[model samples]
Structures are given as C-alpha cells and as structure tokens.
Target chain A: MQAEPEGFDRVLSSMCTEPHPVAREAAERFLATNPGDPGTYPTVAELEDRAITMLGDIAGLDDPSGYVASGGTEANIQAVRIARERARTDGIESPTVVVPESGHFSFRKAADLLDVELILAPTDETHRVELDAVRERVDDATALVVGVAGSTEYGRVDPLGELGEIAHEAGALLHVDAAWGGFVLPFTDHEWTFAQAPVDTMTIDPHKMGQAAIPAGGLLVRDEALLDELAVDTPYLETTSQATLTGTRSGAGVASAVAAMDELWPGGYAAQYDRSQANADWLATRLADLGYDVVDPTLPLVAADVPTPTFEALRDEGWRISRTGTGELRVVCMPHVSRSMLESFVEDLAAVSGRTPTAVPTDD
Target chain B: MQAEPEGFDRVLSSMCTEPHPVAREAAERFLATNPGDPGTYPTVAELEDRAITMLGDIAGLDDPSGYVASGGTEANIQAVRIARERARTDGIESPTVVVPESGHFSFRKAADLLDVELILAPTDETHRVELDAVRERVDDATALVVGVAGSTEYGRVDPLGELGEIAHEAGALLHVDAAWGGFVLPFTDHEWTFAQAPVDTMTIDPHKMGQAAIPAGGLLVRDEALLDELAVDTPYLETTSQATLTGTRSGAGVASAVAAMDELWPGGYAAQYDRSQANADWLATRLADLGYDVVDPTLPLVAADVPTPTFEALRDEGWRISRTGTGELRVVCMPHVSRSMLESFVEDLAAVSGRTPTAVPTDD
Candidate 1:
C-alpha cells in the first residue's frame, strides 16, 4: 500500500548510506538471484567474484579470500569465527577476543554468539583504544584483537599497525573493523588495509561506505585457508562446500557492490569523500562558532557537546541526530546531508542551545 | 554496465522462491531504506513492525517479538543464541542443540557459530525426526530441539507437536525451522506452528514462501523478554537496544515482506497454494504412472527415485533438478514451474529411464 520511498534527503546523522543511482539499478537487476546457490545463477556468481576482487584491491591486498555478506555484523562474526577456529587448531581453549569500547556492538553479538569471552578495553578521551589497556587484556587465550577504523562516535581511526604487531607477537589475529571507513580511507593517507600490517581479517561494509544497497558487507582475509577453516562439506549443493554465515544470500547485494565499485572507484569516491568532508568541516566550524564544543571530524562525522535536554529538544523539533558515548550530539554528514540542511540544523541547534540564534536571513 | 535483469522466466528445478509482483515493487520502492538504523528512515521501520505482526499471526502467534534478518541462517543463528542464553542463565555452561538430519544447514552454521554441540537425531524413512532418537539426545545440557517443518530434500513435515511435548518435558526449548513451510503450512492441515506446540521460536523466510524479495527472514520469539535477552545496549543510536544478528539490515527486505504479506495474506495465498499443489500432483501422478518410484508429496514438492546418470543428464539438458538424500530427483513446483515445463521434464525423464518417451500429439 505504501508508495516509493524517497531517499533520506534531510537526514544528517546518517551512517545509513544510500545506494548510488547506478548501484540501485544494479540491485534491481540481480534481485532474483542468490549467490549462495551459484550454479543456478552463473551471471550473479561471476558478478560476486568480480566485486570481491575489486574490494580486495581497494583493501590493498594482492589476492584475498572473501564473500559478500549481509552487513558488518556477519563479516565481523565470520572474521572472529576464523580466528577462533585457527586458535583452536593451535590448542587454545576458551578463546577470548579483546575489543575497544569504541568497537561496533556487533563484536558483542559475535562474542555472545560464538561463546567467547569479550574483554572490552577502555578508550582514551578521544574514544581511541588505549594500546596499553589492550595489551593488558591479551593473553594466551586471546584469539583476536579488534581495532576500529572510523569509530562510530567520533570517527577516530585506531592505531591498527601497532595493534597488528602486538597481536602477532602474542600469536593472536588482528582484525580491523573498518565497516564505515574502508571505502574512504583508500582515498586518504590513512592505511588500514593489509599493506599497513599483517592484518588477519577485516570487515568492510560496501553498504555503509561503497554506496551500495543494504547487505553488501565484505570479509576479506589474508589467506584462503582462513575461509576454509569455516567451510563445511554440503553433499547436496553443486558448490560442494559452504563457507558463509548465510546459506541463501541476496546476489543483488553482490551485484550492487560491484556496480558501486565500478561507478565509484578510488578516484570517484575521493571526490565524493571531499564533498562529505567539506560539509562535515563546515558544520563543525559553524557549531564551534556558535560556542558549542565540537570534536573536529576525522571523516564526515561530528560530535558536538550538547546536554540531553537540548539534544531531545532538537530531535523534538524534527532534527535527526544521535548521541555519542558521552551523550554529545552526533551528526554524520553523509552525501545525503546537504549544506542547506546543515545550515537549517545549526539554526535549530542555536535555538535549542539558548544562544543568540545565528541569524541567517529568513527567506520568508 | 549491466541492464535490467529479467525475472526467472526460464528457471525450473528452482526451489528458490520468487517474490510476488507487488512485493517486488515494494522492495524497489524502499530500496534506500534501513530499518535497523531507524533514525534516518522511520516509515521503513513501521513497515517492518507491521510485517512482523502479520508473520506472527500467520505463525499462530498472539504477540511475537522478532526482526527482519538477512536470511534463514541469521534467523536460525539468533534463535539458537536465545536458546543458549536461556540455558546459560539456567546454569548450563555447555549447551547442546538437537536437530534432525533433515534440518536445514543453517542449524549447522548456528551450532558452529554459537559454540554449541549439534546432536544430529536420526530420521525415519519418511525424513521425519524420530522421537525416540530425539529423546536419547535431550539432556540437561540440551538447550534446543530443532524440528523441520518442511524437509529441504523431501516435502515432508516433522511431528512438531510431539517434539514440542518432549522438549518441554525435558526443560528444553522447541524451535521449528519453517524457513520454507511458514507460508504453506498454514494453508494446509499441518500442525507445525504455535497452534500445535509450545514452540519457543521459529525461523520463517518471507523470501522463500512469502514470495518477498531476497533477504527477508524473521526469527519470531514467544515473548518480548526472549528477544530482550539477546539485545545489547547500543548507546550511540537513538534505539538503545540491539538484538539482531545484523546492525544495518536491508530496509528493502522489511518493506518487501510487509508488501508480500499485505498482498498474499491467507485468502490470496490459498489460491496460489492451490495452484502449486495441483501442479505438484500432476507431476507426481505422471511420474508414478510412468513406472517411476515417487514419494507422496505433502506440499508442492516431488521427489522421484532417479539414477545419478539421469540426474546429470537432466541438468545437462538444462533441467534444474536436485537430488534428495536418498538419491531421488527433487523438484519444488514453485509458481514459475508451469505445466509445459513439467510435461517437458517428464518427457526427458522417460527417455533417461530407458523408457519410450511419452507420446503427445503436437499442436502443429
């Protein structure tokens, strides 16, 4: 009964990425295919193959083993599953994973699902993992050390190279949770890919940053054996072996990610990233000028210190915003977040903050 | 660069269900929506709410708590997670899940991911879980008992009401894997839902029988607290609690499922189900008359005893037939499997079985 949904044109606190025009069509094109049963749909299977390769190249890997999953949670779960399987092979019982508090809640779900002990380490004031704290948590039972790139709260990139070295020295796997940063970091000087460290696995959400449709997360591993560790023989399927967390994944997601990469590779995404960063920077500057404390965004996210009442007030006034770990108003300037929208938001923020409303001349 | 994809006009041997026309359009309309992160898109979240309600009602649930997930694997995983959590709360350190050999592979994935022991119960000749074997497997450590509503190989439904009694008596939860049967069982006389048993949870795939687009599976729990038991606090987002296996789920999936239910709820689906049964009966009768051994189909599915060479030959001829566990040729007569397709398939099968091809007068 509902009509076509318009994109989130007015959403500013949106890590919920929108599909690019071409990627949206790509999703429609392959909606009927399931890559999990590849034999029935060779075209979609080949598209998935191409998409994974393009993502590996973007992740700075020569050759990587991976699959297009539902989202970051599935990928993160798979990454930790591989780590636990490998750890078990080396006679490690009661596997534990140490993740910073800034890590995505998917890690918590994974720990709960995988029956592993989750050691949540404390973060610094900036919400970056304290390496010393992580070090204290790592032990012989530690199977994985999770580092976040583009921490959801502040858009802070963790020291992955340092964590990788620490994990390797402790005979543990280093997994970079870069679901929100993978597509943009390639355009920046930041190196969160395999080239920067001996990272065992990484969770990259094409849905989040590649501007693909929902359910296009990738789990890229350094070795194919990492994936094989989860592979189980399926006597019924023509594929003979199953490795993914899902049995019947939407091939449309894989096709859309491929189209997204084809349309917005490193260069195209660089331009888009520039636009997002500029918008974020502009919003931060305006908020700072309004006397509200703001964390300078690392990517396209900004967290402004605002009281709970003011935050609730802005939302009540129809401004879409979330809060940070410290209850600060958070805004993610995605491509959908326009300058006019940001300006209007600041006007509302000024009103809620009880500061002299930054008087932008009203058109009315 | 790919153009609009054609629907499965030529696909047969496809157990993979196609979305209803209306639901397909619904998915396209809400392609940009993300119900998981609902701050940006509230309409899609509302659609998800309605879809879960309709699904619960269809499953004979009074008030069910659930989420639209990627597929049956994710739903099955979450169901197992809830069972494990409840078991752990009851002081069972190591949990075990008893599933019949006929259970879908997702149970295997769930067991592997959740660090639980999977005890495979033996099935009778008809592929129904033997209650005696299940009894042998259920202990204090048994957290869950899995009963398949529709076996993947055969269209056989297990005795869920009986299993439910055993599970409840043993202080274990009963979970029905109705990924393929949720939409059909209600239309039939099968008592596989809550109406028949004290079923704690069920995995139903809207993508499969509901005829929604890909990646619309749901895990419906008996109570809200059962869902809350798995929900962890995600402080950054406006929604404080998170329970799904995915974070940023495909809003399109939720939309499509809602649309599917809206378009085909009960009365409308009965007509479709009737057509499917007729088609299946036609195929089974023709095969039986042709001296081919066939299992009596319970739903819109047929399994015929065919040799390995015949199976390969059928695939070589572009007939999309699969094999049952007993090495029988399997065909799920979905909406796309037309009468002409079945007649052509039977003709080929006759030739493959070294019998004279059925003679039919050509239109010409």
Candidate 2:
C-alpha cells in the first residue's frame, strides 16, 4: 500500500482537524454499517439520536429535529430546500434568498441547484452582514435570510437576532451557517443559537471544530415539521420516509459525532476555544508588531496583510496555508495547532519578509 | 463507548457489504484528510484520480470525468442536475425527467430539490422498464431519461441501449444507475455501460458490490464538458472551481475505493460473483421446491413469494432480510454470504412454513 499522507501538523488554513481518539475508534468500529437504513442498523440510529440531542443542548433547543449530513454543504442546501417549500406553500411564485457577501460558497451552489434567486447583501466594516443591506434585499418574495455565525474568510459573527427579525418581518425563515463557530461559540457571548434568535434552521458541523471524523455535519431545526418538506417516501428499506440528501450514508460519522460529544462537551470544548483563541491573538500581535495589517481575532481565525511574494515564500517553505478572497494571508487555529507551531510559523514569516525578529520578554 | 453494532453476518438483503481488508486499512489511514481541498492534501487527491480511472475502465469509458460522490444518491442527483442545466440552455424553462417505477428513491429527492417534473414510467412483467412507457411520457421539456442496470427491487437490468435511443430521440440525456450492478455486470452479458449504449452519465457505487468502505460512490460522465454546469467559483481555496455537491468530503472513501479496486478488479470480483450467483441459485431452487413462487436469480439477487407470517418469523429469528415493493422476499447474495448461511435461512424458512425439507444432494 502507498505510504500514509503527511499529518495535519502543518495544516493551519483548513477548518478541519485531526479526529479525537475516541472519535477515530468509534468511526473504525462502525465503518461498514449504513445508518440510512435505520431499521437494519438500529444501534447507529440510536447513536444519531444521541448526537442530535447533544447538539440540541449546545444549540439551545430543548427538542431538536435533524440528521447527520454529509457535510455543511448538504445541511445548508437542505435548509434552503425547506425555505423554498415553505414559501411555495405561502403562494410565492419565485422565491429568493438573501445571503451576505461573506457567506460560504455553498449558498451559491444551493441557489443554483434549487433555482432560487440569490441576493448577496454587502457586509459592514467588521465583516459582518450589513443590517441595512440585508433589510433592503429581503422583500415579500424572499424565502430565507442567511447569517454567518463565524464566516470562512473572516471569523466575524453576524447579528443573528436582528437578521431573524428582518427575515420574519418579510415572511421568510432564518438560517444561520455556524458550521465553524458552533463548537467554539458556546464559550463566548454570541447570540447565534435557537434560544437567542428565531432561527428556523442552523448548520453546525461536528467535523470542523468538534474533533469528530469527517462527514459529521449537523443540521438542526427548531421544529420537526420543517424536515417534512425534504422528505421522500422510501419504498424498499426499513424506513418509510427519508429526509436526508444522500441515501446509504455510513454509520461512522454518526458514531464518531456521538463519541466526540460524549468525550468533550461543555468543558473540553471551552478549554480548546480558549487555547485556540489565545494562539490566534498571539499570531495577530506578532504580525501587527511587524508592521502588517491584521484583522481582529473575533474567533480562532487570523487574517493578515502579507505581501503576495511573502505569502508565496511561506507556502513554498512547506507551510499549508491559504489566502482570503481579498488576498490576505489566512490561518485557522484549529485544535491541532499549538503555541510552538505558531512560533515556528512566525520565524518563517520573519525570514520570508526579510525582517528582524522582535525582542520580547518570555513568560516561561 | 457503546458496543459496536451487530456485524453483517445474516445481512442478505442490503446492497452494502463488509469492506475488504485493504479498503478498511486505507480508510483508517485517510480518515482525517479532506479531499475537498485538494491543494492541501495532494496524496488523497491523486488517489481519487486513480479511483476515477479504474472506475472508467470498468464502466467502458476510456476517459471518465467525475468525482467520488458521497453515495449513489448524490451521483444520481448530479446527473439530473446536469441534464436539467443542459435542457435549460436549450430554452426549456420547466424541465422534466422520466424514470422507471423501479428506479431508486433518490431520483424522487432529486426531482423535488431541482424543481423538475418527475414522470414515472411503467415497468414490464420481467421487472424491466418498459421502453414504450418511457417514450410516451417523454416530451420536449424532458431533461433526462433514467434506466436501471440492476434495480433495487428485483435485480433486473433495463434495456439500456434502447432506453438511450428513446431518450436521444426526445432530445434528453440518458443516465444509467448501475450502482448495485457495476461490479458484477462485468462478469455477465449485460450491456449497461458507456460502450454498450449512448449513456451520458452513470452512477456506480464502490461501497456496494465493490467491497470498499461506505461513501465511495462513483459518478462517471462520458464527456468532461457535462461537469461545467455544476462548477462554482471557490475563492479562498487553492482550487479555483469545485463541482462537487459537498464542500468538505472525507478522503477515507477516495483512498478506500482505490485500494479496493487495485486489490480486487476483474479476477477477484469475477470469482466472488460466481460464488454469490451459485448461492442465489441454490436458495431460489430450495424456495421453489417448497412450493413458493420465486423470481429468477438474476445478478445474485433472489426474490421469492414467502408468506407474510413466514417473513415476519424470519425477521423475528434474527435473519436480516427485506422485501420488494410488490412484497416479495428479497435476498441479495453479497460477498459476505455463504452457502451455509443460505442453508440455515432455508431451514428456518421451512420451519416457519410448517413444511418438511426435501432431501437434496449436497455439493460439499
């Protein structure tokens, strides 16, 4: 067999990280099982229920109705499908969804697939969706209004509560894409959950920051009835109706999600958020000290204004980094990222930029 | 953690089977890597390319253009999306798709999500799709015509060459769903691939008869240009455009597919299919001798007319089996199935029906 690929030790730009030990074990155990046929694989189905319950607790919903999606893209697409169906029932001929320009590209795919008009609302100075712009785009024909809890390019949380109000006033539903922020926002004071706002649906992925295996993306709905729009009558298998986008999904992701949440929920996730946030802050301070423009570390993601040549040099030096749409260097401080790794990155950055290292007092 | 779910010991009705040992090892090695961002994870991305090449060789396409989908559902959905986009370019505002009544439920989900009209064509007495019904239902607005290579209900193959001709006559694309039959059909005389007909797209799942891990579904297109309709601009990622439905897909499925195909291609799959076909024939003869109506054992799947009470008793006795839409007991002889297992099932079936077993010569 071919040698295993390089580990995630130097991957600082991706939202995904290495799976938790328990999550890996769980995934291996259930790798061959299919959770799509719930009646045939009852154990994994029950595990999926437990995963949803735990996710509901974190998202501030007493009762949650959702499934483990293939990823955040599937969850986001399903949310749009529900909104479109609801609007069709209310006599809307051509449905439209208002999403921030800072939203992930999955919304664009959803708009194209579902044949809904996509209206991109501008963002404010903080990189959050502009409230005036969102209000202007949403009208009576709007089916859904999307808000990003922690955006991909810039880790800025949108005003979810006010976005919900604007959507509801226009007879539309609110969907918050918190795929990257759901695991960390519980440690902060962000009103981005079902309890704080009238969020009809939310996308929270376990594989991103929850340290679960890949494909464990969550799609939570405030009411179970919302899933009825996506249901299709399954003739042959055990289940009568299936709501998920993909049939024959593996039980590995469902089991891994349950295992990861059981191992680290409120306490472990809180500590991880603190460490990752501190690392982002440290990197931002170092970059600013070097006379580079840096975005505020609202979450655990940092963006800095490094020259194109310097960014290319850093990448050529075996650092798995990426850049934002506006050509700023972007790095996501996932759980696998450590303080020493960031220090080494700074040394490389200093060398690539041809600048002397700043002398600072060491706490240790 | 909770005990692992029951193994696939008595699972005789599911399309999925236990993963090959090599596939399991490959899945474990690539569990945390995301193939969605191919620039960061080049190893798994190259493995995905290898998988597509092998799939193309098996599907009779020299140059296949597709990706590793989450499962057959996503592949089927993408096929419909491609056809719909092509039809729209031809000035068709409201597109429709014609599928056999025996088609998988995923097509229903696709039609609903893509906002297309779904017209179900009647099936013939042999459980194959009636070409006349498909021709009568198709119109200028029809975007695609779907055919089943190995149907989920009765393990029947539709006349793919004729279906393609009828679809082409109506200016519609032909999509063959060979998800369950792709692996075994190479050993048979079935004309269900790109070389046999004018098939525009095909869905073949590695997790099914290919003995790979779950979520290793293949979507093959004859021409690369068909994928252009699904592309979306990915800004932050290194790749400029992505055509996949999911954003962050796991590399486990991609690596497992390559490993499984490399280990077991024509020779190994042919031997296994021979053994499975013999087992299915043996079971079908035993049930027929017991005075029950039985469908022909086509493609290693047997459907028999067992009484409802007997079927319930078999389930109560822990035999993992399912039924068809017409209520015939269905048994799919997967790679894990053995002759002794079928003999045990027959003994239980005889007991449940209050019948004495006939003495037959055993080929030990």
Give the per-residue Cα lDDT of candidate 2 at B344: 91
Share of reference contacts found in each model: 0.66, 0.78
What TM-scores do the predictions have?
Answer: 0.95, 0.97
Provide the lowest-lDDT 10-residue window in model 1 chain B. B355-364
lDDT, candidate 2, A1-364, per-residue tens: 5758778778888899999999999999999988899767878988999999999999999989999999999999999999999999999989999999999999999999999999999998899999999988999999999999999998889999999999999999999999999999999998998999899999999999999998799999999999998999987786789999999997899999999999999898999999999999999999887777899999999998888888888889888888999999999999999999999999998877876545331211
Docking class of 2: medium
Per-candidate chain B TM: 0.94, 0.97
Alpha-carbon shift of residue A69 in model 1 (angstroms): 1.0
Which tens-of-lDDT digit does each residue in A190-303 have in candidate 1? Answer: 768898877889998888878998879988988888899888766456677889988888877988999999998978889889988999899999977776778989888998
Best by DockQ: 2
TM-score of chain B of 1: 0.94
Clashes of 2: 0
lDDT of 1 by residue, B257-350 (tens): 9988998898877877888889889988997777667888889888887678777887887765667656787888887778888888888877
